[model samples]
Target: MRTEGDTWDIVSSVGMTALFVAAIRAAETKQPDALVHDEFAALFVAAAGDPDTNRLIDDPELWADSPLGLGFMGLRSKFFDDHFRAATEAGVRQAVILAAGLDARAYRLDWPQGMVVYEIDQPKVLEFKGQVLADAHATPTADRREVAVDLRDNWPAALIEEGFDPARPTVWSAEGLLPYLPGAAQDALFARIDQLSAPGSSLATDTFGSDVDFQQLADFQTEQMRDTSFGKIDIADLLYTDDRSDPAEWLTKQGWTTKAAPPEELAARYDRPLTEVLEPYAQMFNGMKYLTAVKPS
Candidate 1:
């Protein structure tokens, strides 16, 4: 029996690719075209292409008719891109993208020599991506490793089975995955990561802010999500713990020094004028949280 989270994860696996396509469009808007990711975005999309995934793009619908969705995803992408590059520069050599749904970073960034990227996702999703790249003859920039496992399962064991090094530092991301997991699962998820991560590991995630009425947000995305093969999976209770006490701060008390940036600040960072479109998100969702926590030396 597939759970609600399982349903939503697959949907996000399909839906999240829109951000890359939006990034490409944003690049075109730049004077000389400010492109941050590699050309592999298009290639990956083609390789992973399916009717359900392609429908949203072909429909000519932007995430928000305004700029909130596009702006949010864009700013967040560039921010993590910087943090990831910085981690590599600071000597962190391993990256594991959790819920690795449709992200093309393996073929995008110019990783230093010997950098390894292990992407973890559902078996079906993982198989699709691996096959796509192979079929397209796309070479990855980093030493690409794929760990096929459900995030809610004993994935740490699966990752260890895949030869993940416990002694090495790793950069990890939970981008857009928390929404489907139950709150208890969210708490336990990081504990598992803590057990595996060594000193100097870095993590980035977006959390639901205190102000956002998740129930309402769920109602908003329900229609849009329902129209696709991958429909909405509601787990409103799964959002980050409230109290303005961030998930990052929680990790900090656990020996990780954390830094958090609100969505407005992120929008400013990316030069996206999102006042009108972002008002709802800004007032709600406490402005869509982006947080990074690093294990201290």
Candidate 2:
């Protein structure tokens, strides 16, 4: 059964954070040519029903010129674009997106031939998303698979039973899922992935945003959660057991050779022009470090 906390997790997470990714993609597509799949953003929003899931979706003015928001989104897009590209180039035919929510990459991105993408999330979430996509008549570009299961459950066993290949290199992305899981659960989750993944497997995920002083977001979100009938669930309470100084450092303990990159460097690599100097607040939070780790082959 899905708890109110779980549902609120979906509510608070959608728009405020996505503003960055969506806007960057929106701006990029306006160019004569762009990188990766520009259309993925629209399909993702249509499938997710931005307003239906995210409370702030109706208020467009909240993030006018939001550098912090865009920075975060830009980071995510660049990370995913790099990881997925590497997965295909490395001959990885299997990919898994945990707590897939309303992500539309399965329908938008051009996956390598024979690649199968499995998305795992709740039944209702997946059901609503499939219905929305069907209504939109959106066509998927990859060999798409949807597995409706709570991340805390025996999803690894279920996935293996469903024919997930342990021998082949798999591209695994955790994205926004970690914030919703308890710390112990997060540990177990990584352990399961490690057990299931073979050498040469790559993992990419966003760590906690520095700005989330989580207490403030918790106080404000608590009131909003209660008002929405989602209850007074503290996000910080339900997830994140190990807060690390370096996400890459922690992964190294798991036998992954890791590299951490700050946002400023990433912008340069993507050829995005640097405008104003970054605000201390924005650079500290949301403008987090991203880490990529690979299991030894």
Candidate 3:
């Protein structure tokens, strides 16, 4: 649980979730025909220097027990990878990754020349990621910029001050972010994005279903996390879990052409099926969609 004074860095609750995802990505990377490959992910885990995290990364059996969860992460990573590739190929040079935590896309992806990738997150999160990549002597494929600010703050101003050009087309992503924000904040985020985006700009995001009994699942997951090797961090504590509007439908009404798909469909397209054990978790993700929307030129 996060206290009011709890400042987040890479190892905290919400921030540590990034490391958890990276651990899964690292595990997937070892497999043949891996959907996504993050070369720097393993390095970040080792750099964390925590015994529990090290155990989670080292023990493949932990991920093997939840094949559906593992597959979902891989599919999600691939989906975002495809999104960025298409965006860059379409000549959208400016890209922003919201809450970019332990994401090595800038370092691993083969971005084109003259592309600028901006990563937005809290100051400590970005600072820690930079330090880890620096220690490993890794280099990004694009001109990467870091915008250190909280999403609840006047982040648009901070982003613009850090060289974001609102007049040009941009590709924006909000992966693993919305559920943590209050409902009103989520709406405000989209409003801000719409204001900053020029015609031809595109956005990609992942959202949870609004109909699920979130409190029930949050309680269940909280108990599960306590007994697991992942430690005592109840992720429920970090999430706002308020009812959020469907981003795809909302974006369409805002004049952007949008497409959405459930995780099952995306997993099948990648030749990875969700396992039976994941059904309970999937229910919580009911109506959960990976969405992409584009403003008309």
Best-fitting candidate, scored by lDDT: 3
| TM-scores of the candidates in the order shown | 0.80, 0.75, 0.93
Per-residue CA lDDT of candidate 3, range 34-142, in tens?
Answer: 8988988888888877666666556766546453245778898999999999999999999999999999999999999999999999899999899999998888999
Show pairs that collide, candidate 3: none
- Model 2, 206-277: lDDT tens digits are 765534565555555455444322233454455453453345666688898877676667777877654564
Q: Candidate 1, residues 1-297: lDDT per residue as tens digits?
A: 224445332335333433344333333223232425445444544454445444544443534443434545557667778878989999998888988866778877889999989888877777766776787788898998899877778899888887799789989888777755656677778888888899999999887655667666555555545664323444343344333335776797898988888777876777765546433334554656788999987
Candidate 2 runs further than 4 Å off = 1-40, 43-61, 65-71, 209-212, 217-247, 273-280, 283-287
Give the better candidate number (1 or 3) by lDDT: 3
Q: Once model 2 is optimally superposed onto the true structure by TM-score, how far is the C-alpha of residue 243 displaced, in angstroms?
A: 5.8
Candidate 3: global Cα-lDDT? 0.82
Error of 3 at 67 (Å): 5.8
Error of 2 at 95 (Å): 0.6
Candidate 3 clashes: the total is 0
